[model samples]
Target: MNWILLIIAGLFEVGFATCLGKAKEATGNSALFWMIGFFVCLSISMFLLYRATLTLPIGTAYAVWTGIGAVGTVLVGVFIFKEPATFWRIFFLTTLIGSIAGLKFVSN
Candidate 1:
């Protein structure tokens, strides 16, 4: 389904974001490797987003896509990158999750 593709695309968005973070922390060949991964993930994410948009409403799809990416990237930051998980961050994350789920339920 297009929604599934959109979700997958959102995941790839997370992958690219993670790769960027890793690339930033890396040097020499390691940085190059992560950069390559970033480009690959970016390409796949864009392709899936394009495919999903063929049927899904653009506004809804884009919002959901970015929502998923934002949520996933934040979690990744907290877990993988050792970023602080403050109270406000968690509170807003919960709301964002609710919004994403609400969009899914309200959408066709």
Candidate 2:
């Protein structure tokens, strides 16, 4: 259950990051809304991360959380922002995802 929360938190991390990017590109009232979303998502992500740390090893939780966020963010960038999805980038992202899964599998 904790791991599940952690994963959801990681997804929220991706949400916040994407919101930040949109906020950066936005103007006037649009930027305000995106900024609000960024803060809300960030708060939820951090809170869930902290909650997971109560039961899970902090180091493992944090690493996995960040790994999920990083990979998810890269995917969102490629698909939504039309960022380059070069072979090497996809390869590295896949490697990171594998590492994240390995961590989850090895954790107590």
Candidate 3:
């Protein structure tokens, strides 16, 4: 359950980050809405992350959380924002995923 929570938190982290980026492009009331959504999601993600770390080691928990978020955010950036998705970018993302999996196994 803690691991599940951690994954959910990671997803929220991606959502908030994407919202923040979109908020920067927004104008007027819509911008405020997106900004608030970003902060709210960010706060919830942090809280869930804290809960997850209570059971999981900080190093493992943080690595997993940030890894998921980073990879997810990059994918969102490419798909949603139409950013470049070069071979090198995907190669690095795969490396990060592998490292996270290795760390989780070793830590366990």
Candidate 4:
């Protein structure tokens, strides 16, 4: 259950980051909405992450949470926002995923 919460929190982290990015490009009411959403999601995600860390190992929890959020955010930036998805960018993402998986296994 804690792991599930952690994953959900990670997803929210991605959501907040994407929202913040969009907010940066927005104007007026739309910008305010995006900004609010970003902060709310970010706050919730952090709280959930804290809860998860109480039961899960700190290193493992933080690694998985941050890893998923970062990878998801970059993918969102590339696919949704049409940001650069260069070869080097992909290479590092793959490396990060692999390292996170390795860490998970070792921690388990």
lDDT of 3 by residue, 46-71 (tens): 99999999899998999999999999
20-79 per-residue lDDT for model 1 (tens digits): 999999999999999999999999999999999999889889999999999999999999
- Residue lDDT tens for model 4, 20-75: 99999999999999999999999999999999999999989999999999999999
lDDT of 3 at 98: 99
Quote the lDDT for 29 in model 2.
99
Residue range 1-108, candidate 2, lDDT tens digits: 999999999999999999999999999999999999999999999999999999999999999999999999999999989999999999999899899999998999
TM-score per prediction, in order, is 0.98, 0.98, 0.96, 0.94
Q: In candidate 4, which residue pairs clash?
A: none
lDDT of each: 0.97, 0.96, 0.94, 0.94
Candidates sorted on TM-score, descending: 2, 1, 3, 4
Candidate 3: misplaced stretches above 4 Å? none
lDDT leaderboard ranking: 1, 2, 3, 4
Error of 1 at 15 (Å): 0.2
User: Given candidate 2, what's the lDDT at residue 31?
Assistant: 100
- Clash number for candidate 1: 0
Q: What is the Cα-based lDDT of residue 67 in candidate 4?
A: 96
Model 2 segments beyond 4 Å from truth?
Answer: none
Residue 43 in candidate 2 has what lDDT? 99
